[model samples]
Target: MKDIQSLPPGPKPHPFFGNLLEFQRDQLKFVERMQRTYGDMVTMHAGPRPFVLLFRPEYVRYLLTEHPRDFMATQSAGGDLMEVLGESLLTIEGEAHRQQRRLVQPAFHKKRVESYADYMVQYTQEMLDTWHEGEVVDIAQAMQQLTLRIVVRSLFALELLDQIDEMGRNFSQMIEHRRSLLARLLNIYVDLPFTLYGKRMSAKRRIDAFIYKLIRERKAEGQDHGDVLSMLLATQDEEHPLSEQQIRDHVITFMAAGHETTANALNWTFYLLAQNPEPREKLLQELQTVLAGRTPTLNDLPNLPYTEWVINESMRVYPPVWAMGRKSLVPFEMGGYHFPEGMTFLFSQWVIHHHPDLWQDPNTFRPERWNPENDEKVQPWSYFPFGGGPRICIGMPFAQLEAKLLLATIMQRYTPRLIPGFPVVPKPRVTLRLKHGLRMKVERTATVVKDSVTMI
Candidate 1:
């Protein structure tokens, strides 16, 4: 407990605002500099609140796995997120999280996810079919649309592919506008009302309404559709089934988390591949040898090692859910840090993944580093794209399979090239997407067909 006083070290903050201004401009830069100067753990003041940044993988492991109950996800300032997320598993802790996880687990089972492979392939191919050779659009936007439709089909069982562009735009505005820099910077000021945010609040309400309507109609029908909604309904405990509110919360949570994260991962995947052709060519060669231009399946994924590594490495470089915010529930001393209950602790995958000590040539886009022989060199909590411990991404397997399948299918039929000098900056909104879209040109690959011997 005595070590808590020295809990990492950092440059003293400036007067009243502390490090808040500098942290807001670029949180990643602040973190890297702290690690460079302060070593593992560093303390910084966010307004009046003191935040301890744990940079070492070992300590991050302790926070997430070894001492999970000791920490909690810090409260959001506005308090709207709780209403939006409801008592869903993502927000809950202890017994509540355990119960919700049990109810939600079966829906994303390996067999359930494997069954979804066809829908993913169909959707990816459909999008690729529409792309005209030599034409360019924001490849990131294209990936978002593709992944959104896949989520719609897999999770909602809603045939809304044609309507996606309209719905997706509105949903995007709602997410971005609500979390605007102004809102974040001004969060410390308590005078403003929730409605002051204007249209974003309205958009969020509408999204909630739309999801509730779907839940109502599904309930009225009362038949299993073999999708996530159906699975949630089918699951129940001794006293009662999930309430209407519970259903809405889970649906909205899934859409927000499931849709956005996967899209960004795909966007980064394509961007990295476009920039590095050697790996792309190698991936294509593997596809050719393994499936011979046919769509990939679960059975085929294990053999497509390079393709899998490409996606894995892309996630390493730009993890969609960049940081985990935890507040200590009880006084506990950590590696050379003091014990203080209620202190907010941040564990950033953004920092951990690129920690120079953990990764070789940390900034380079190299996929081979994840190969079997090199994976051992990686450390715990240092490279968690889908998090770790008991509360790991339930859809981890499902997400991985969907991503690899989509990549294989698209790479087989078309070679997408990044438009020269396209602004590929990451906008760390709800997920890491391009502040400006990732533009790319696609060239169709010739399909090879071989005839069986029928000579008389």
Candidate 2:
């Protein structure tokens, strides 16, 4: 094994805090500066733990695909994810992760996912119905609420409907609590009402109570509701039936993963489109010609290539999951440096997607870069907004479908223009969010309106 001196170059760290303060100060900018100064692989530290930040596409491919078993996914927000997510697919590794993935796989099958399109379109229309011309709205929050409703109805098949808003509030509060740097660093667990950790725990309790109640009801009914919860309740290994907690874990995982990332993606997409009128017009023209002011269906997705490209480009610019961490399972050497077991490695979608080596003008919002003609030239892992390899997000298909349908539905009805001089900043939390939220004024579109559009 190479000596410690063989480690890649990076910014000097503090004796005790290491690079934790620098990293927490501004994670995106810190990484970008490191990449620009230190090159592809840079050794850094977070507290006493050493970390190597990787910026190359090949390194990403190697870690995620070539040597996946040598590393495992890391827990985010200081291991508190386990307390909230339980042993669901997001938190586990190795055989347990595989088994849980197997049990949950059928729920995301193309056919099964496509069956939810009716709900996606219906929910988008319901949200749009609330919009009025010349009124400013926080599009970010709107997307979150819209996706929350869609995910609840489509995945849990919950009919209470009214409780969805409460559920969404709790989930949002839990995420906000986790976003607290002090809370994460301290790993706080004080159960007082005023504390962030306490608030987080309270949110978890409410979410758990709701999910367990649903699981118990589903078990008692023993009938297919044609939803993910129903499917999980029905499927069982010969030797091992899924426990009530297991079911709750899967439901919560889907509830959090299903809606939050998609909402951020849609938020970024609208923000990008507002800033780039040329591409926005191109996307609008595609919606006019293909969708023709009618609601979009699953079949029309293939016809809307530009719409897909716009979403792809937006994700490249502001990936919802901006970075992911994986801890080494055993000693391994990568990029000419030896890494000891338990070393944490981070790869940023923001860095690689904006790297000059990958694209002609990486920072420029250019949708045409994703055209079919350039597909062959695009490198593997170069634009992994949803990550890569076996653990690549299972909700990718669901998120893509939701984004396109929502974009089409919203754009066809109203044009969201960003309020001038309103600051829109990307805040990297569990997902990349707008620090101040996206404020925009909605203006009515001139597309021919059908008397009524029916869901398929």
Best by TM-score: 2
Residue pairs that clash (backbone atoms under 3 angstroms), model 1: 4-337, 4-338
What are the RMSD figures for all models against the true structure?
4.0, 3.1
> What is the C-alpha local distance difference test score of candidate 1?
0.76
Candidate 2 residue lDDT tens string, 130-150: 888899999988888888888
The pairs that clash in candidate 2 are: none
lDDT of 1 by residue, 1-456 (tens): 334355567778776677877876766677778888888788887765567887778887887799887877653222345634677767788877878888888988888989988888988888887878777867777877888787778777988977788667756765665544445546632323354345555666777887888888888999999899988877877765688888777777777777778888888888888888788778777887798867787788879899889998999999887777778899887774566887887777778899888889988889999888865577766798887777888878878888899889888887778877777787765456678878888877544445542110
**Candidate 2 error regions (>4 Å):** 1-3, 76-79, 179-188, 374-376, 447-456
Error of 2 at 334 (Å): 1.3
Query: Best by lDDT, which number?
Result: 2
What C-alpha lDDT values do all the predictions have? 0.76, 0.85
